[model samples]
Target: MPELDAEKLKENALTSIRLGIEDFQRSKLEKDQGGDPARALSAVRNLFAGILLLFKYKIAVSVDATGDASVLIFNPPEVLPQADGKGGIEWKPVGKFKRTTIDVATIKKRFEGFGIDVDWPTIDKLQECRNHLEHLHPANTLGEVADFVAELFPVLREFILTQLNEQPADLLDTAWPVMLAHHEFFRDTIAECQASWAAAGVPEMMQPWLESCQCEECGSSLLRPSQQDIEEGASVDNQDNTFKYVCVACGHSDLIAPLMIKELNDAYYDDPRDGGEADVEECNECKRSTFLISEQHCLWCGAELDYPTCTFCEEPLRQEDQFNGGLCGYHLHAYEKAMRDD
Candidate 1:
């Protein structure tokens, strides 16, 4: 078998990286000119793959065990010492047909074992977004995808220059400019979004939800409250019906309740289609499914639920049992039995 040395691994990594960068450049250009958002999806996938390969390349270079690169192979077989004591623990692939490299999780653990300082969380974020894109993504997620790459670019640059001892200019070439431009654009837009959110005077408790909120129509997360309305004596109280938001990217407008409830449900609950239960219950006052059971309040109509006490027994009943007309479970059952007998 031809040897897969560190240099060979480096070449493969560069190839993947270059391809990813070219895709990213095209994606950015397309986005600027109002092209397909799916373009960024390809870039995200390629970039994530290339980043993993770069990490593997570094790990391969660091393995100095008698020039054996079997450590890079996934589930490398171990050769125990023979009876004659000729061989110690050695790594070899179990199957001759195909050899798979270590996966991302394994690579992360290996880096930890080797005391390599990689920004794993950042990488994980990219991987998460990539996975999301592969399954289901919004129509215009170019900004979000760019944000992921922008966050990881500096880390990749540092690793290439300092850890791998390779100049990014030589390796990345034209891709470098594309990465920098997108990064700068991401930073500037993020700053603008932050400023708009900050100036809107959204309550502290609602800030987290707003940060994660995406425009359902356009799939953009660049949503901000209507600051002009807020300035003109509008209230954003959780129960307030006057608050409105606008998606800066798509110019889509919506009321705070619908937007927040959707975000809250998405963040908290799994998909019911996949056997997930709804997190929020129906609000008694507004009759909307925005009553947060935990918080004991309606996100839509702002109804603070007060569980009624059982009329006969004078015991506090849970919200779910409220349908029994102020009766606890036992009392409700007893009343039903009494009614049957009568």
Candidate 2:
């Protein structure tokens, strides 16, 4: 049997005992407040038991009373064999004694090896809670502590299993039920946050910014009223005629005016033609409304005009060669000459 390093063993026993007492006190408070005090008590008892086991394995042990209860301490046993012909018992001070601190970076690296993205923010939050638990007097209530543990245990257990190369199901026999309850609480909190944000009217910048915008759901912009039309105080011509702007994206629709249909159409298909430019053509049949272009056939009887003719020059004009400003080039020159003679 290897002799234990007395100082190191003593420190380990002391630290575990202190932690156990703290857990015991916390458990008592929780029990007083209708919490599962048994679990907390059990954790503390396990801590002590683990310490006693180290003592049985030839680690150092001692006792002290600092707070309200006596503390049992156990140090780590050394495993190296003796150099002399003496029995395999050797004691050599390894290093300075210090409380066992969790190697966070090491644990994180191990978790990464298992392909789990470590949620740093959550880890930070849990660490903050742990610090609060250790330092704060009249420590957090049972509900608060349990809530913290509930949030932390899943992540911790995951990390532990990954490090140990154990299947999660195998570890779940010890940690699953608590984790499920904790996850439920986590989900509820997230839902509440989402609802609160929604109720607060969190602006959706992605929504289209047109007054006559189509209903996100239906893709029909027919019922939407233009901002200009609405400002003009126009009413729908038929009250019974219901129209809706249907959204193509979300299938949402909004009831709007028939006027909105025209406005949206105009807005969507704006004519690129300049506002002041007037296209003029002459009609061979009547010669009236000479300033009007036969957009489709003849303006008089709707007969398809062969093509536009010059009103002043009385010459047939090709579609592309039609006169601008109501006169062909020759007639424009003649008009200028007549004006000069006058």
Candidate 3:
């Protein structure tokens, strides 16, 4: 069997760290836009979770200031060794070999063996972010913190992609199983959030509103499986068919369409097919709140709703007014005058 490519493994580990940062940034954005701050904070914590995974693989190292001086920490996985006969020599397990004062030179040498370049500036930036997260509570604005995370994601992603691409086909194939596991873990987390939102009685219209406003990966729109789902050992295939929303871009199963009150109204009163009750509900983005009426104003905002252009003058209307009907009183006379010339 071919030996594992240490370099590729290192890259994959680092890439996971970067993806965690991206997840954090997305969560931060959702919080800024009036979504759940608790969920966003959880995403930030998951970044450290990713770091712990990387540490297990020896791809990255971490240092913490416990009291005053800095201390390097290792979190390698545990390994069992075969017992030797005479006086049974015990092998040093991976986890027990914690080096408080890690030799930076030695760590660099190991990383170099895996063909990873450890530049001071890059390391410094990563350290800065980690320090801010660890020590400072309100070090920067949410936007600023998010921007810092955004800056790190692509760099880490590219490095991992390159490492994967450089590896032999077999090595690359070996990584697929681990990658799939990670994706499933993230997907499950999303499902848990969805269950929470559903229980909270969040409106269905508001679900799409959240989707449009937040990142798809770390967005509140992504549903999380409930505690019941976990306890029942619910498999993905057994999820409620009506609850699934397939992604248009990546074809991922993440979102669940909520049952809206408006939809029920349309079903009984409007559409007779499924028996023709209202076949479709109102548009989520426009907040129509009812069936579309021809040449009528917005039901909620009372703005004149028009299609394409003004009905009289055939000129494009301002976006704010277009949904309402034509324009306001100011543009009405102008449109009428233009029609007279025609």
lDDT of 2 by residue, 103-162 (tens): 344334433543545556766665555554444333223333444545555654564354
What global local distance difference test value does model 2 have? Answer: 0.41
Best by lDDT: 1
| Model 1 misplaced stretches (Cα beyond 4 Å) | 30-38, 74-94, 135-141, 154-173, 199-203, 226-257, 271-276, 285-288, 295-317, 322-328, 331-342
| Candidate lDDT (C-alpha), each | 0.70, 0.41, 0.42
List the candidates ranked by TM-score, beginning with the highest: 1, 2, 3
Model 2 earns a TM-score of 0.30
lDDT tens digits by residue: candidate 3, 260-325: 333333333653555543433353344544323333433323344446466666665443455446
How does residue 301 of candidate 2 score in lDDT?
30
TM-score of each: 0.72, 0.30, 0.28
Q: Looking at candidate 3, what is the lDDT of residue 337?
A: 86
Clashes of 2: 18
Off by over 4 Å in 2: 1-121, 137-143, 160-162, 201-342
